[model samples]
Target chain A: MERPELPLPQLHAFVVLAEELHFGRAATRLGIAQPPLSQQIRRLEGKVGYDLFSREPGRIGLTPAGRELLPAARHALTHLALGLTAAREVGSGRAGRLRIGFAASLALTVLPSLLRTFRERFPAVDLDIQEMTTTPQLAALRERTIDIGLLREPPAHDAELGFETVLMEPFVAVLPASHLLAGQRAVRVEQLADCPFVLLPRAVGPPLYDQITGLCIAAGFTPQVTQHAVEWQTICALVGTGLGVSLAPESIRRIRLKGVAFRRIEPSTVRTRVAVAWRKNDPSPLVPGILAALNQGPPGRP
Target chain B: MERPELPLPQLHAFVVLAEELHFGRAATRLGIAQPPLSQQIRRLEGKVGYDLFSREPGRIGLTPAGRELLPAARHALTHLALGLTAAREVGSGRAGRLRIGFAASLALTVLPSLLRTFRERFPAVDLDIQEMTTTPQLAALRERTIDIGLLREPPAHDAELGFETVLMEPFVAVLPASHLLAGQRAVRVEQLADCPFVLLPRAVGPPLYDQITGLCIAAGFTPQVTQHAVEWQTICALVGTGLGVSLAPESIRRIRLKGVAFRRIEPSTVRTRVAVAWRKNDPSPLVPGILAALNQGPPGRP
Candidate 1:
């Protein structure tokens, strides 16, 4: 037989009454008056075709039927409350997953602080973090393969993208420990104008390459080229072996290479800009929470 | 941080729109005008502090936020529906547990049929069944240790109890297999006047005891007691051992005792009434379902 459909409001009223066991108290708990509570109970009984409570001179108690119905009523109320909580959490982006791609260099910059604060505040969000170079990260962002991206300032041609610059750090020079000027705290670009340069390959994309080459041209002479490496760490390792010198973001100082030494440029004017990029049209709920965490990280270095 | 309480109605609207991906179709499904649905979505976006849908020249799609909120919205709605079902089942006496007490002899009479039907009709009810004597069963019913009881007719003193007769079977004479009367198809109370009788102890309760003694007195002779057994099975076994003959309800003929034979009593006017009883004031929901099953069992013999 098909089960009867109970009115939610009445069942909710009955549940509170069953717990309080007194009309006045139950009504107070329900934020209503005793007479209305009594009417509701009566209506419930009328609908159920039986009495749920037995009334006596000064006592009130559930009939056997009421006792049987109590647990089910409680269960229904509990589930409804839980459902409400879950809906709110998901709607506000406090629960669910976020797929974010970051330039490998970010692991040493704002990524750590950003991730820690985000996790502490929104632990229910499953962060799917991948480390990729800026090029691939930009591609993933536009293709919608990743929800968010942290990359070097993206190229201007992509008008369909939006980005926020979150970090800026000055570039430093990496040299073999035994180089003639390796012990100097600051190196003038003109002093090494004829030295062979170990640079990131042009095929690795142009942002960092342009920054390094622009500084050299401003110093009045371009460095002679020697070899190319795909990564900053590889560039540092090659420089340590006396292959050539290269420029890197200052955050790479944390790598602590045994044979390599870092020096600030005498007139340090070149800095790397790290920006968060996403498809301008993508409207994910989690983006706000993630952006909030990123914005709240420590202020960018001077 | 405080969590936002998203309005359920708005989330529901967003979920349906997300699924349909078309404003007009979703509005039709929700039985409202498309403008109102759009307004609801706007209100929801305002509350969430983010747009849920990304609309373009004639097409719409979930923004990342909308996609994330969809599953949770669906979950909340589903749980709410389930909660309603559970509440209705309990209020209508279809879910929950029923603690039932029955006389041991009921296992051979109406008990099986009553249980089968009750289970079939209300499968969600957890049946906690126990066997107890009429005296204790009455006490249990009064104390609310059990919700319902099956027993021989209770005394008239129990005005606070309600009962329905579910089984009525005439008494029969139980004889030793070799007794002279055993070969006869019928036995008269007068024929057993000079023979020893085995009977249930009066200390157990008055229902069966009064019926047995009342029948003997009406027949013009009191039974000469030879033994007292607490249970019908023990009395039947004693008769099988030829210790003494006894009278039993007709249903006992199904026991198939090896050394005892049953004979119908002449002018068989004495019958045992088996009833299902509960406290008159019991407001439990389970009692009605149980009573319905009990009443629907095969009708009692005249």
Candidate 2:
């Protein structure tokens, strides 16, 4: 309720710390850096607007408010841990349920084949999948609602979540099927210099968005953004409506919309990388299994 | 089991801090300095042989050991405060009770007069008195069992307990009734150089014992300590037996031993001062009342 947010990891930190009362042990239990664990508490105090512990020089104690807050905090954490276990149990469906979120383009390419190979390797494991952009996938991974995430342009700088690229593909030119250059084998990026573009919002995938804009910049012109859509299929449908042209991951070619044309971008150096990601502290067994499946073989339309 | 003992004030500190969870508020509640409060906790942790609180930079928590110790510590503290309350009630008999401890010699002098005036002012206040040495009196004061202490050569530097000098008297040379020095109205300290002395051990009253030795040294001799007694009356009776002569406060003359003679020390510069001591943070009404009454009159045989 106070500004940006109270991060959830800090809640876990509070409960463990309250029980242990020792910093070194609690940090070890939390599997986090000890220094960050302390910083997290200060930030949490800032969010809580009241301190949970009395940090006198030679002693530490719970204030009245802290004592009062203890039961509730314990309740939330215990229930959360329980819910995680229950959800984990139900999700796995005896074998295990792996909830996965992926970028729109990945669904058309890596998704089907990855699922096929994963089903072959672990047939009993249930696959619960959702279409998501890179931004929301990261959030889902952190919240632990999804055990694994398959998304494009994974944030390499984020140290809290682990990521491994599963696929890399160059940009393709997407235009209305009836466009004048639709029959060409490939088109130079500069050829679309005057065309209006349809693009995903930068917030959804900052790195990919920057790469697309950078490609246009390198080609000596900025494509006028005429519209936006979160899904590649929607972007293609909009392009099919003769709305605008756009440059996107090559995986967009697999969407198969009748009126949309995908052509290679000449000198196509701008590319998008799709990566699988998960919370670093995620305890789910399915996470590693899924990662293994993603790397077992080259994915394709089988 | 450890050396120097675990200070009890630290225990009180732990409970209050454990409850408040905030150093500033806990310090205010304890009526103690904030800086020392932290130091007290650290010392308490050392006594515990385990950290009771995790003092991470931005956070503080109780370790499992701390959590386990909480209930017991709370029990000890609650009962102590309650016992103190019950004792206070029984001591005062509805008005208020004041338990006092005094240096052994004061029982023969300042003790009786101070009690009479104090009783006169607060007629309903119950009086419980004990004759104890300075060291034990300090322990009793810290334990909160005794409301006030009347002792000699009080430690002026003790920051925890407040001291007010109530009476000061010069040393008297105590000797056998038939001794050569017994006929003199007064004697210089050097005159007792050859006599064996009866005195209280240094352990019972360090400063007083030091003063006696210091006075003898200043007079170019060290009175040989051939006998020791805790009470001045015993010292007088020992002197009566001709076992030894001793330097004592003038108040020792009031003991009226049959075979002992008391003569004022010539200079009178060497004196023993009796002080009323009480815990600074003591909340009882009788303590201040007794202090006022003690200051109200000049103590004497009356």
Candidate 3:
């Protein structure tokens, strides 16, 4: 057999009446007259084919049938309200989760601080961070699995991701302190045109490697690159052995090595930019906070 | 007048039967027998004093009232389900916003890359970032307005914000190429201890300034500081005037300034760390993404 149907207005009246136990109060809460509230509840009971409440003169209470439905009715109304609120919040940019896919390298230098500051400012938000390559980050973002990305340089497939320049730094030459040019007053890139260099792997992408190569060419000659290492520290270690010279960011000086010497190149050529990237239509509440922290760093102590 | 009540079992039966449309299917869906479903509907009709359905011996259809209540019932159920899901997700650290506060200085070098990587990995998460001073960042984190922070060293009120090291670099001296130290192999801090020094302002905090002072003291004298600037590049410009030497990170080499020389200090003593900070008990979803990014940096990029 099919279930009985009840009108929403009548059911709503029944719920309010059930709570207030009085037509006058329920009507007031519903912004309706007392007579109409009573009529609606009666109509609701009639539609359900059940006696939802017992009335004796001025007193009224729920019948067994009415008692059984109170919880479910309340539950339905609450959920409806919440859903509406959430929809509004999402549209206003005040809520919703931001799925992010990122390269692993950002975790060490800037990601921590950026994340910390972001979290400290927006506590009522959700975040999903995943480790991914630039290719996957872009792919996932396009698929709506992620909303933003942290990447180096511009992607070969730039149409999919919106890139914003955030950080940029020039490359420094790492050599042994005892090298003949180490004592020179600001060495020129041409001075090391013939020196063997340790470089990032070819797999890192030709664009970046080509950038370094191009810089060397602009400095007057091609570099004699000997080894390829993925991490900057490894390249510095090779340079410490006096085997060759390598180019890295000035930040590398922070990672001390016993025999490594860092020098600025004249007519600086290789500048690397790390960027914040996101899909054009991505909407995540955390995006604003993360961006703000990135621009401002963390708060002060005390 | 008193409003009538609604029967619990009848509402439950109504919802299930409405979805299934057949007594046997509805009963099966509700994990109950068809007889009970029938009995509950009859009881509901008795309580409401109306016909909720038009029943023909072997078939049934909802009355007008039934149509109106369907949406409300569905809404309530959805909310109940979502409430439970949200609670579980928040407890598991898989959802919820992370508020963050930060200072302006970090925006340049490290913040952008971190935020970009985080957004890419956690597109469904929310982040809130606030730009503030170091003191306010710490206070906000403590007051629960923020979940994390990013700032420089000597953080005040260790009792409030927990600090973690993210990036560290040593100070290098910036001078004019025409200066006497430009020709030196490696100048000690004491060599220009009495020379006018361009220093960062006290607003940046005493810890940092003291570090510079401490380095000079360790080198056997105090620096004769003259001008004070707010930012690193500004101090570098002052150094370019041949007025004095300034200490800064090797990263400062990125800024192009005519007639400036960068030199390494012997027995280097000044080092600065950029850190990620947060309250001890923050339970925001954005925290994990940020933490993951900070620990790994961007993924796949060499």
Q: Is 2 or 3 the stronger prediction by DockQ? A: 3
> Candidate 1 lDDT, tens digit per residue, B2-97?
122455566667878988899999888878899999998999888666677899758698765666566666664555456445545766777877
Candidate structures ordered by lDDT, highest first: 1, 2, 3
Q: Say which docking band candidate 1 falls in.
A: acceptable
Instruction: Give residue A298's lDDT in candidate 1 (0 to 100).
Output: 70
lDDT of 2 at A113: 80
Model 3, position B283: C-alpha lDDT score: 37
Best-fitting candidate, scored by DockQ: 1
| Model 3 interface CAPRI class | incorrect
Looking at candidate 2, what is the lDDT of residue A96? 55
TM-score of chain A of 3: 0.78
* CA displacement after TM-score superposition, residue A206 of candidate 1 (Å): 2.4
Q: Summarize candidate 2's per-residue lDDT along B1-302 as a digit string, tens digits.
A: 00113344676677788877778788888887899999989997775565667664554655444554566555434443443333334333335567899877777677777888878877766789988889899999988778799888998678779998887788889989989999999999999998999999899889999999999999999879988988888888989999989998887777887999989887788778788899776655577788878878556541
Candidate 3's error at A282, in angstroms? Answer: 1.8
Fnat, one value per model: 0.14, 0.00, 0.10
